[model samples]
Target: MADLDGDFESAESGASETYPQQCSALRKNGHVMLKGHACKIVEMSTSKTGKHGHAKVHLTGIDIFSGSKHEDICPSTHNMDVPNVCRKEYQLNNIDDGYMSLMDENGEQREDLKVPANDLGREITKKFDNGETFNVTVLKAVGNEAVIGIKCQTS
Candidate 1:
């Protein structure tokens, strides 16, 4: 019998682990990187295999921030990269020509950020004009960040 207990060892203390995933494992509403763009998968379909080929998977996704649609086809067994996504809350501080400033929970300010094009974005625009400090949800993935939604703070 082989020593199976020691076969699985933990990685380096602070090193993050990332692995490729098969196309068939993807699901709708999942975040993935397509053509170097961070997108959220909106639809997915798989086709039966032909005479001598493998099954093909069709994926349609939209840019999380830009709302642009992108589609691609790949073998069901094909490997795809999945991006790490995070969401955080922040407060609107100011708005510039094409960017808005935000302050985090720790009072740290980030300026000159383009507002996303979505309901939350529209709400932010409307609230900013009235000098309101609303809570904003930011989605971070694949080294990019964008505003996803706004939260109304209640006293």
Candidate 2:
């Protein structure tokens, strides 16, 4: 509905979570999207051009957050989606019932986030139980965020 004041709200909401890049340009130890999951490239190989036409790029990557492996094959000239990954540090305020209360450098706090179910998550839980202070490193990409690393805070 149009208002008399002609006011409208725009929501971008990270519309471009990923960008397209030629498969030939992708490199080892880089980031890419395979099978609709954001992953970190671990191995890549290109097959020589054959009767099939353009050379085929074979990619093998591990999911950034899930740790599951994904494989993909595409023409070298084809484009692949690359996730825009970022990391931030947050202070560990508290953990209640397997949920984390985290505060960022700007002092903004977020609660009720479930602890990641992985090795890093276990380490964070163990450290917090001992009354230690540290900052957690959060990795964000494609609308997904996870606690990936930790830095001990010195008082």
Candidate 3:
């Protein structure tokens, strides 16, 4: 019911008078707003039951530190809120061509990210994975890479 882009808040608003807050993960049948959570999208899949059934989005994510996997079902018709902030925890897979390749706990490729050492401070070559270690920060997504602000360690 909140003001969204233009007045297209609901798909059935033109002829219907009621709005449902929850939606199904298939056939785009439901709608709801979501809040931000520190997680990364590890995998995504889509499917449908039959010709008359709706489509669904299967999403898999991993907790940045705990490395626990989280799954969700999102309907195709659902008006989900894409979080403005993106966060990820990964291991220093390797560095090449002024870019860094990181392997997330889920073993997903989060690569080709160019992060400046000065931005991370202290020549951060730490190995973090399998509950060994991890870092958290707000990420701004620009194209394929993310711009992160590393919190400076205080003495």
The candidate, 1 or 3, that scores higher on TM-score is 1
TM-score of model 2 vs. true structure: 0.87
Question: In candidate 3, which residue ranges exceed 4 Å CA deviation?
Answer: 1-36, 49-51, 86-155
| Candidate 2: Cα lDDT at 46 | 97
lDDT of 2 by residue, 67-120 (tens): 899999999999999999999999998999888999998999998568888888
Those runs of model 1 whose alpha carbons end farther than 4 Å from true positions after fitting are: 1-19, 96-98, 116-122
Assess the local accuracy of residue 133 in candidate 2 as a C-alpha lDDT between 0 and 100.
93
Worst 10 residues of 3 by lDDT: 26-35
Q: Candidate 1 residues 47-155, lDDT tens each?
A: 9999999999998999886889988898999898777777998888787876888888899998856887667667789998998768888888765788888888777
TM-score of each: 0.74, 0.87, 0.33
User: Order the candidates by lDDT, highest first — what do you get?
Assistant: 2, 1, 3
The better candidate by lDDT, 2 or 3, is: 2
- Give me the displacement of residue 141 in model 1, in angstroms: 2.2
How many angstroms is residue 11 displaced in model 2 relative to the true structure, after the best TM-score fit?
2.1
Better of 1 and 2 by TM-score: 2
